[model samples]
Target: MSDQPRSYLVLASQRSGSTLLVESLRTTGQAGEPQEFFQYLPSTSLAPQPREWFAGVDDENILRLLAPWKPGTPSMETPQEWRARILDAGRTPNGVWGGKLMWNQTPLLTAWADGLAGRQADDPDAGDLKTAIEDVLGPDVLLVHVARKDTVAQAVSMWRAVQTQVWRGRADPEVDARAEYNADGIAHLHAILEDQERQWARWFGEAGVEPLEIDYHELASDTTGQVARVLVALGLDPELAPPPALQRQGNDRSNDWIERYRAERISV
Candidate 1:
């Protein structure tokens, strides 16, 4: 690849409908199709690993590209390689490409800054991911940060999901919050939610990366129009609309998670 057009990241808080947004953008083709692994973090990425628990991913070498900090994984090791991967994913083989993934820059950046200062953080995985973009995809990579209501409801919803998923024989990865909540007032969950949102918001403030802020209420209200707004912001032709190829899998349902969170907030 010629170090030309590449991909960008979508920074947002979890459960803020990021998956839905990415799906919508990719379908419209503003952002190129996300790697199949975009849904789940590929286990075998570089840097942070005690990953013995990871069996393997559906794509063998795909993890190599994603493990953006790996020593020899094309992108992480060589700027040229990283550029190539970006181009491969950014535009089409014919050169119409864009790539996007939801990322949390808070801890990711802290670890990176610490490493450059000659100290490693808990997660040694570090890479100047922005190097892979800069002027490639576009001057502005369209970092979008989303915010919703408070955390009491979020924690309740997450707890419920854990139970429901388990009952269905589909357990999510266990998180220590379960123990802490049972031990304490579940205030930890609220703290975590607020912490991450603040971290991300502060990141925008400190780093001078003014991301497009999308409120939960705005998107939920007008889906297509909001998507078009984003497309316009990204300089993608609004007339293009995302390629239908990236259409969402199912209709946006009752959104039990958001509804449950909201309802609980009222009750509280």
Candidate 2:
């Protein structure tokens, strides 16, 4: 209802440096808490498990490396309740709201939005994606597209994470030590990451929406600058952007896996 934008959404995929950007944004007290609010699966009420990523892959070798699937309780919140929680949880005292949305979780968002729409009105347009986002976050939400240029590196990072179940900060040395490099597993994630990026681009093109774009390398190297850019877009003070503190999760092992996967793919 205010003239200033009160909500912002980060459009990104797994292991794309989105966490770094969001965490930085969150440090600024003015910026609303930017979390991966849409990653949960309605059926499991949990973010996708490690084995779930390799669902169609019948490779026992790859399957054996990933953590075994564990069932989770389903979310019981109705559309209105879910909407209220997300809106409240993501907001700061300043009334600004922020959250992250991956391409894979769009279905869950749309379904929840549809349920809300059905309850609110009989209008057919209320169930659309744009309408859904507006219905929950208001009409002036700033959209930010955080992306990684290198799919191989992204996939390699994701492969390691899926194995360890540690997405942020440092992983346990003993637990991370157990993660093995599987070319097929990395390749599988590479394809998924590529497709998710492609879908974001295509959707933006089709919808005629031009979001503020952030590159992974640029974000990593100049995190404060990147966060300032988003704050500027949101009509907030750029000086509120916090200095970068989080370190990159990638390391020598990730680099080795990237090179190995490239070499194996080239030979095939």
Candidate 3:
């Protein structure tokens, strides 16, 4: 039997079904809490964020440098709490815990320490995480990151989220995305996505971690099929029974109103 504890992460950006994917994973009784990795929501628009663990990283902001969540969310449980919850379920005999985090917070996550003997602030990408995984869980740890189309569409979905005041945990002060997403907003949004993608690609290439990339539209069109792809990548058959509490969304995605708004705003 493998001696390393089994753990994994789901990587994606905001407004890209990362949370919904988490919900799907939550169905596995013994899986784990769907963790939004990068907790700090950047108020300032910039490429490289405060690399607390990168080349200049010198402090203990492991979570801060990463997580981009509202600080005071009610349902926001600590990583340890999530781990304990899974352990309590007793379903994870191999100690497999699936946690998630977003890579869009790339500005911050480029530097993180898995609490091992060696330090790797220089190589803040897949290779470093793979190292940590090997030491603790061997090569069993998986790095799964999800990808969406582009900024224009992603902005539409994210904008809807801001307007509808979406929240998986405690609600934060509502943001008028209409006001937030203007001409300048569109420009910046594109920049952020591009920068994040660049870094993610580099990390994925150098880290030696196997990559799993999927489009959001593909997932929405066929939840069961797409999830099966994910499960297979995770080394399991995707055709598992659904959880009793799984709520199906009956909305038709064919009508993409928000996407229209994003396209219209491109000129202005």
The lDDT of each candidate is 0.45, 0.88, 0.49
* Deviation from native of the Cα of residue 56 in model 2, angstroms: 1.6
Instruction: Identify the runs in model 3 with alpha carbons over 4 angstroms from their true place.
Output: 1-5, 37-94, 106-129, 132-138, 160-181, 235-237, 241-268
Kindly list the per-residue Cα lDDT of model 3 for residues 1-268, writing each as its tens digit: 2543346667766656566666666565434544554454333322323232133333343223232433332334443453344334423443556655556453333322232334444544433545533443345655667777755666544433433344344223343222233333333445565666677777788866566666766665665566665555555546751432233221233125444555666565
Candidate 1 achieves a global lDDT of: 0.45
Predicted structure with the largest lDDT when compared to the true one: 2
Write one digit per residue (lDDT tens) for candidate 2, span 1-268: 3576889999999999989988999999888988888888888899999988988899998999887788998888998999999889999999989999999988778788878767444666654667778877878989999999988899999999999999999898999999999888888998999999999999898878899999999999899999999998888889988888587888998899889888888555
* Poorly placed runs, candidate 1 (over 4 Å): 1-7, 35-43, 46-87, 90-139, 160-187, 239-268
Q: Indicate the residue-level lDDT of 62 in model 3.
A: 28
Clash count for candidate 1 is 16
Candidate 1 C-alpha lDDT tens digits along 1-268:
3443334456654445555566667776445664422222223333232121122433433222222233323224233444456467655443445444334333433333344434443434343344323433445455666666645544543343322222112233452222112212223344555676777666567657776777755765555666676667655666655432222211122144435445544454
Indicate the worst ten consecutive residues by lDDT in candidate 3. 45-54
Count residue pairs with overlapping backbones in model 2: 0
By descending TM-score, how would the candidates be arranged?
Answer: 2, 3, 1
Sort every candidate by lDDT, greatest first.
Answer: 2, 3, 1
TM-scores, all models, native as reference: 0.54, 0.95, 0.60
RMSD (CA, Å), candidate 2 to true, equals: 2.2
Error of 3 at 92 (Å): 4.8
